[model samples]
Target: MFGRPQLVFLLLLLVAGLAWLRLPGDEQRVRTALIMGTLVEIRLAGDPQQFNPAIDAAFAEMSRVEKLFSSQLAESDVSQLSFSTEPFQVTEESAALLQRGRQIARQSDGAFDMSLGALKQLWGVETENPQVPSAEQLQQALAGVGPEALQIEGRTVSKSNPHLQIDLGGIAKGYAVDRALEILRRAGVTSAAVNAGGDIGLLGSREDGKPWRIGIQHPRKQDELLTTLILTDRAVVTSGDYERFFEKDGVRYHHIFDPRSGYPARDCQSVTVVAADVASADALATAAFVLGPQQGLQLLEQLPQVEGLLVAADGTLHRTSGLAALEP
Candidate 1:
């Protein structure tokens, strides 16, 4: 067998060839890594010359926003703000994101607390082998998670204790998608969609004035779409244990955690939110997962502009009462 380094080299060569093949001739299709996140695709639909520098500039702006919000980077503004003993200083943009985070935490009744970072570290969701933490470890982490622990004054955020770490990975991707749409709109791109790791935000109608059709991944079936959403200038965000999980002795542990117990929520398989903006959709996806199917639907009914689709642990799909109206 070939050595591990040789195997990696072969994989890189294969991926590069595939990427080159995917690009169309005459129109420069650029797929570049942005914000230490996923690969972003910038495709020119019409004549290549019609594309302006503003389009590329928008991508750069998105990368800057990602760095500001990412907790994975030890030097990120969010990391410092979350751990700051004094009031954390923030720019106008970062302040707006933190304000939105607080609004969602209040609306979700602590279900979507941003202070659940310590508990996330204990579970190691992105790690290769995720585990169930000991009850003692969980208890200590849970002590630092709650909306009451966060104090947001305008753009400044201060935690009551040093143990609290803020992880916006759950919502930042969607928020970034929305910010990208704003940039695209300002650049005179009428019809566009930003898919940041499947957190989608739709701009204006398609070139032909038709709404964009989005496929919702089936929770149990790999090749099937549960439903198709016809969106026009809306944002859709989904969170699910089905995407990533560790199965131990037939029990699966996923990333969506319950702040109360610091454990992977034993509730829904997936939750999808469609809203006017990405920030609300992002927060609602996590909140609904923690609330489970029934209470999650109930919560959606209370919000006029938000609709939800929930897949239960047993694979049954439940949608908010208002979902029918938004169906294409």
Candidate 2:
């Protein structure tokens, strides 16, 4: 679901002496809450006084979106729809997300089903006592996960099955980043990056007008980089098993579940997707992980705007031809 070690390293790097080492004119620094169903770091750089207000407004807007999409909050629109029998109406932003979810579900052959909320609860991935769900529970969840069960009409969300639940965990954060970036750009912030966990959306370039250099971490090695790429106004998102998991007997169960089996898909070690936007990258990364390394590469080739980097379970690296040219 995320690159845990990479994310931790980035957090540590931010606070460990790196904050004081700034370029000649790149002295601006502002901190804001990054919305990902929880508050995380959203650091901005530029002229502190002027940039501070824009950063604050962007984060405030993101927070408002978080409340709309979060499933953890019992009062959220997503949560209310999970239990409601009637068609749940949503705002334009939410409706757009639902439409994107359905499009990915269709394109990924149900590999990226948004209707996995019930399955997620059964596994308790966010709970303190995470364990394997019972057979009965898995069966009930499986019954509710088919993409056909979901229906989106204008601004209303409905399901053919009342028990069907939708979870936007795979796409929400990236969507939020895109929304935030739009706000930042509108505020005249040209050089910026919005990193929602490992999903990053870059704008223009770094302060020196150079493309932002980002590394793709090696799945098997903690401190190694599989490859690095230069990005400008693009989004990078990784879907992997390393983020959260627990072992049952000898088998390791991760948070990313396959809707078909109500269990984690096990073919690829990780899938990193780079796209024109964060939401697309986020959705495609999850889909690529489910598609496995070979098919995932094929899928990326077919997509005109999406490129992918896949790490197989056997420690092999796979990417599109264009990506090979960009890889370092």
Candidate 3:
């Protein structure tokens, strides 16, 4: 879901080091905290005193969501639901996210699945020591890997197979970003940016009355940018093979797995999605990465408020017509 040190480095370079616009006004109130296993940054342009509290409130909202959605946490709704044999009732937040994930999985033709928890555990992609699972192990994991296994009815969810587990790494952070933005808006913040690692949600313009400039990190190059975008009131998210991966005898094994193959998605090197909401952008980026270039762009075309940029394995770049128009 998140790249490690490299992701942190790229975020610092883009959010802090890179200057977007600085104008005479209240000092930019910025707060950064470690949440959702990554850095979450919130920046507001307003009276420092008033906006500072708003920033604090926003971080609190993020933390609250993290506790509710984190699969790693024992007390989280996701964890409890995973361990339950009977129907598990969940919070409205959890139910909504799960329902949304199911819709995306169906739309992507199972290219992106929420029921891949067993497969992830078998491959050990989230651990420091990731190893390739044997064919037998892969088969066993695949038995519990399908969106149909999990059933959601209102605020209660149940799984036909007890082994079926759900992991929200792909969409949870973006949902948190949206929730944080809601908090900021309620606090009267009209112009702000909430960045969770590479998934970002923005509102209004910068202090200089200019659109916020965001640099897209090069998929294959470190400390280099493929392009920059000028955006306002939009969410931009990127999912890349470079984020989390391990190498075995010169072959790289990444975290983005193809539901059909039970292996890392090799169609695209990286994918960037821009949409009106962070959750949609984040989920679509992952789905597009699995679908590769042609199908990925086609999916974006069908989406009304979405556009995408896909970097293929051959180093060719592809973009939706809408995204191409926004390229700086």
Candidate 4:
């Protein structure tokens, strides 16, 4: 979901590699795993005994969610829905995610789409061998790429076009992070942070009562940070071309695709969205990245309780009115 396989690993390493300067009284327990094709990290500031069960439960919940939504798994609901033209009954969770995807597609004017699976496969962005498809192949793939082609009734979903494929890659990670955090909270974990690839969710404060400092990766620079934000009980999700891309003939082809053009969006290098929920942050980051700076900021302005930081193709940074104030 974060782009290519290697880029996903790099982003996870960048986030997990961040140095944690804990206070004298801060006792943090951390665990890391590669799940859902990305690195998932869970950090808790509490007693070790209390953290163990919570961490274990959190990871188990993430695995369950992945099984339900991952497009890679043939048994996943998303795969079932994609492979079959008939109305496929799914879990309430999958239904809800599909509903959310449709809403965002409408809100973003199709800038964010969940039915890009065919196009993704055509481009082989998630595969070990990725290549540019021919114009005819791209056109064929694009034919089935649109949110409107999907029909959802209650917990049943079917595509109007039999060739249409659905992919929740743009939003599933955020939902997984949300569920993991919920599991931790229910397990008596008062202060915890879940960083799934780059989509992060936090609850409560650090052991010292200070806000969690999350560093945003520089769009073009692997060893640098664009900025860091103080957050508590908030979600920060970033989508960037730098995360997964390949250069061909000096042209960089990345994973974040434009539904209309059937190619990588060229507006922004990366986009970070901060919101109350991880799902919104994740989807909006991709939407804004496709929308570019001017329109992307405009979309952020229209949404309540959502702020964004966009790195343009030229490497210039732009932020929502509120996010600028949060930067140092």
Q: Number of clashes in every candidate structure? A: 0, 0, 0, 0
Query: Residue-wise lDDT of candidate 3 within 54-134, one digit each (tens)?
Result: 888888999999999888898999889888889999998899998998888888877778878778887887698899988
Please write out the lDDT profile of model 2 over residues 1-328, one tens digit for every residue: 3379898877887875565664543435535464664444444556667777877777877787788889978888888888899898878778889898888778888888888888888898778888798888899887857666678889988877788777889888888888888888998998888777788888888877888888887777789887898888899998888877888899989988877777888988889999999988998899889888888788877888788899888878888878876665
Clashing pairs in 4: none
In model 3, which range of ten residues has the least summed lDDT? 17-26
The 10-residue segment with the lowest total lDDT in model 1: 25-34
Runs with alpha carbons beyond 4 Å of true place in candidate 1: 1-36, 41-44
Spell out the clash pairs found in candidate 3. none
Worst 10 residues of 4 by lDDT: 19-28
Please write out the lDDT profile of model 4 over residues 213-252, one tens digit for every residue: 9999998778999899888899999999988887778888
Give the alpha carbon lDDT tens digit for every residue of 88-129 in model 1.
777778778767887778777778878888888888877875
Q: For candidate 1, list the clashing residue pairs, or say none.
A: none
Q: What are the lDDT scores of the predictions, listed in order?
A: 0.78, 0.81, 0.86, 0.87
TM-score of each: 0.86, 0.89, 0.90, 0.90
Candidate topping lDDT: 4
